[model samples]
Every structure is written in structure tokens, then in C-alpha cells.
Target: MPDRNSAAHRAMAAAVARMPDPVSYQETALLETDLVAAFGTCRAVAVSSGTAAITTALAACGIGEGHEVLLPAVTVVMTVAAVAACGARPVFVDSAADGRGMDLNDLAAKTGPATRAVVAVHLAGRTDGIHDLAAYTRATGLRLIEDACQAQGTTSGGRQAGTIGDMGCFSLKDGKLLACGEGGYLLTDNTDLAARAAAYRTHWQSDAPDAPAGTHLGVNFRLAEPLAALARHHLTRFPEALAQRREQAAALHRAVDGTPGLEPITAAAGEEPNGYAALWRLTLPDPRAFAARLAQAGVPNSTGTHRLTAAHLHPACSRFASGDLPHARVTVDALLAVPFTEHDTDEAIHRRALTIRREAVRWTR
Candidate 1:
């Protein structure tokens, strides 16, 4: 959580005071401009939430009923929900050998005639296999959308995470790096897609002469003024916040280096992680026991955090399940995630690391 007296709060207050009307796009447009400049994208569309961003992007791409979208098995349920909202069926792709990213082979095996797009998730802020996934999608003529909600400050091969795909979506929810309570945006270089997204987010209200009113089906997904102002303020502090997170993550890594049964999950070559959380592969026989110990020690952690099961297994999406995704299931069981937020102090991180080391020693014994 941000301080109540912080610049972000001040920005929100200012936006609220200056609003002349109820449905204003002043601050929202400014936030979109900042996002475009920051991410080097040609255009940006601010929406109500991350889910809205994905749904709008999908609609902009002309995907709908009878379309099948490929998404990693290891992802939040919201990703699948977004596809469902667009009347598309989600095809779950298995995780890679390390359980960090999508398995390209599985993605290839799953791509069929109904497949129209792919949503590549940069899980835990790591952009490890996105480039390869992008290449594969291009070869198959499939549209690629990057779920970069956890990778605000991340990069891969010198390019921003969201800009690498046809379209990218980011979250600004409470726990996210650029939080504004609840907001999200989409980034893309395509002029047509950007124009469509802009129109789709606001009831398909377009200024184009040739486009009719409600040219395409759309709903109200606009970002509120105050939230957009707060998000803009947070964007200014992002560089410093990201640096702090990296430092803390490095400290945690050093502390857990020699601890038995704990192995740090690192980024692949040429990829940069945004340090959303310090992740590890728990080699211990009982990962749940280790996680419980960490929680008892005041260092709250997660095994998979809403990714414990494949998205297809969720009751809302059970009808889409085609087969078992063993790797995603195994990976979730063996993984451990420790979040390091902007609010955490160095001492707090050190204490958490010590607790992890202590617990690892006890559990391995």
C-alpha cells in the first residue's frame, strides 16, 4: 500500500478536484500518453481492469465464438475468464521443464484449426520464453497477446515485454507494481488494433467518418479519472521502486544460496525479471510443510497463488478441459513464491531470508 500522504494520493485528490464533468477522459488520456512513451508503443488504451484489457484486445483482434486461444496452464484464472468473456475456448498449454514458462512443444501440439491467438504469460515477472513463443506464433500466423501484468519493469532482448507481442496487457491492481487500486492498459504498435481497442473500451464510440455508431459490440470499460491520475503518479516512481525490489531480491538470493532443498529460479539469458516475487523450486519432499513453516515465521508465502491447478480445472472453465496438463500440476506443487513489495524494508527482507534458510535446514533434516 502507498502512503496516504504520498504524491500518488495528492495526484488523485487533484484529479478529483479538477474534474468538470462525471464522465471525463482528461486524466485517462494523459495516463495513456505516459504509457505509450514509457513502453515505446504506438498507442495505449486504459481500461477498468486487467481482465478488461485482455477482453478488449481480443475483441479488437476480431476473435469470438468458435475461436480457440492458447494460454499457459500455469496462470491466474482471470486469463481464462477473459477468453471466455470473448466467447472463445481456452486451450491450456503445458509448462516448460523448469515450470517457469510455456512448453513450446506442447503449444505446438495444441495449436489446431480453431486456434486464432495465443496469450503468453510472463509469470512471476520473468520474460524467459516469450521471444520463442512470439516466433512460433508468427510462424503459425497466430496473433500473440502478452499477459505482462506481473512484469511492469521487465524486458527481454532489449525490448519491453508488452511491445514484443501483437498486443500486451498490464494490471494496476492493489498488489501490482503500478497499482492504482484497480486499473489496466493495453499496448500495441498496430494502428488498426489500437484504434479498435480505443473504440471498444468506450462503447465503440468512434470519431471516424466511415465507422457507424456501435460499429462493433463493446461495453463501458473506461478507467476512472482518479485511478488514472494515481497510476500516472506511480509510473514516475517505477524506476526507483524496481531498483529497490531488485536489491531486495538479490539479498534474498544471497541469504538462501547454500540452504539445503531450496533453489532459486532465475531468468534465462537476455531476459530481465521485474522482481515481483522471489521464486524457488522446493526440492523438499513436502512443499506444503515448508510453506506453512514460512507463514508461521511471519514470512507469508505461496505455493502457486491462484495457479495451483490448471485453468481448465476451474469450475467456470471445466467445459474447456480437453486433456491433463501434468507438468503444470507438478510444477505448482513443487514451487514456492515469496513476494518482496515496495513496502518491505531491507531488515524485513533479511529477516524473511533468515527464516527461509532456517526452515529449509529443518525441513531437509
Candidate 2:
């Protein structure tokens, strides 16, 4: 969340004051420009929320009824909801052995004739294994969409996480590294996809006077001007915020370096994480218990977000829901997450690290 005293708040205030109707105004266009420049993408389309971004991206890519879209099992329910919204079947892929990303082998085994696309979620802002996943999707002739909502500044194989796939989606919702209370954007080098997304976000309304009638269905997914203004202000400071998060994550990693049964889930080779959340693998029998203990010690932690449950378990995703995915279940059960913010001082992070180390030592004993 942006501080009340920060420039982001001021930007939002200015937008509110200047525009009585803040729907898809100049500020929103300017924010889209900033997003393209920041991420080095050819085009970006700002939308209402991350879920809307995902749905628009999928629809733009021509995924709809009867098409099977493969996405990781260890993701927020919204990802699955997006597929369902497109009238497509959501196919759940198991997590990798390390629990960091989708298992390519499992994805291959699940892909069938109906598979139209694959959504690679950069879980916890870590793009580990994404390059390989991209390669696999390309080889299999499947459209690749990166769900990079949590990966604002993450990179994999020398390319930005979101730009590696055919289309990437990002969330500017509060709590994300790049926040604007509630907004998101889609990125793609394909001009056709970009144009389709632009139309899809605005109820298929095109500005061209002689343009053909839109055949694709769409809804109102325009980003409000005030939110876009807030995002723009935060975008200017994102580099510094990313650096601070990395520093804080490193401090915590060092503190737990030698602790038994506790291991930091660092990025894989060729992947640079944005440090959105400090994650670790707890070898202890009960990671949820350790997370609870950390919370009691004044350190907020989680086994994963509540939305990390298997997609098939969610009532909203029952149309394509299947049996439990073993790897995703194991990964969720063993993973531990520690929250951090751009405003956290070094001393504050250090204190949290000390508490984590103390708790780890006590828990293992």
C-alpha cells in the first residue's frame, strides 16, 4: 500500500481533483506508457484488475469454450477463475519437485488435444524454471501466458519474466510490488494480441470510424484515472523499492543460513527474484506449526496464502476440477513465507530475522 504521505497519494489526489469522471482518461494512458517503458515491452494494456487482465489476455489469444488451459496447481484461485471466465477448461499442473514452479514433466503428461495454452505463474516473484517452461510450451505449440502479478522486477534467463511468454499479465493491486490499490496490465509483443486486448478491455469498442464490427465479446475493464496515477507514481520508485526488498531478503537468508531443518528457497540459476516474499522450505514435520509459532513471536508468516489451495477444491472451479495434485499439496504443506514491505527498515528486517532464527532453533529442538 502507498503511504498516505507519499507522492503516490498526492498523485491520486491530483487525479481525483482534476477529473470528475476518471474512467480511462489521460492519466491511464500515461501509466500504460510508463509500464511499457519500465518493462521494455512493445505494448501494454491497462485494465481494471489482475483477474480481468488474465481473462482479457486469454480471450485475446483465442482461448474459449472447450479449450483446455494448463496452469499450475499452486496458484491463487483467481488464475483458475480466469480460465473459467473464458468458458475454457482449467487443467491443473503439479508443482516441481522443489515446489518452486510447474513441473514440466507433469505438464507434458497432462497436455492433450484440447490444450490451447499454458499459464506460467511466477509464484512469489520467483521466475525459476520459467525459461524451460516457455521452451516446452513453444515446442508443444501451446500459447504461453505468464501470470506475473507478483513478479514486477523479476528476471529469468536474461529476459523479464512477463516478456518471455506470448502474453504476460501483472497486478497493480495493493500488496504487490507495483501497487495502485486495484489495477493490472497485459504485455505482449504481438501487435494483434495487443490490439485485441485493447478492444476487449473496453467492450470491443474501437476508435476507428470504418473499423469492422467486433466479433469478440468484452466487458468494462478500464483502469480508473486515479488508480493509474497512483501506479505511475509508484512505478517511478519501483527500482529503489526492489533493491530494498532484496537487501531485506538477503539479511533473512543469512540469518537462517546454518539453521537445521530450515532452508531459504532462493532463486534457481539464471533467475533473479524480486523478493516479494521471503520463502523457505521447512524440513520440520509441521511447517504450519512453525509459521504459527513465528506469528506468535511477532513475525507474520504463512504456509502460503489462503488462496494457495488446490484449484479443484474450490467450488467456483468445479467445472474442470479433478483429484488432488500430490506435488502441489506437498509443496504447499512444506513451504513457509515471511512477509515484507518496501518501508521495512534494515533494523526492522534484522529483528525479524533474529526472531525467525530463534524460532527455528527452538522448533527444531
Give the number of the best model, judged by TM-score: 1
The alpha-carbon RMSD values of the candidates against the true structure, listed in the order shown, are 9.5, 9.6
Runs of candidate 1 with Cα error greater than 4 angstroms are 1-24, 207-211, 304-307
* Candidate 1 clashes between residue pairs 3 or more apart in a chain or in different chains: none
Runs of candidate 2 exceeding 4 Å displacement: 1-24, 207-214, 304-307, 313-319
Model 1 scores a TM of 0.89
Residue-by-residue lDDT tens digits, candidate 2, 247-360: 777877877677778777878898888888788888886876777777777786654234345566656666676777888887877777776776777788889888878887
Best by lDDT: 1
Q: What is the TM-score of each candidate against the true structure?
A: 0.89, 0.87
- lDDT (Cα, tens digit) per residue for candidate 1, span 76-192: 788999999999999998898878689998999889999999999877788768889889988999999998988888888999888899999999998788889999999999988
Residue 348 error for model 2, in Å?
Answer: 2.7
lDDT (Cα, 0-100) at 342 in candidate 1: 79
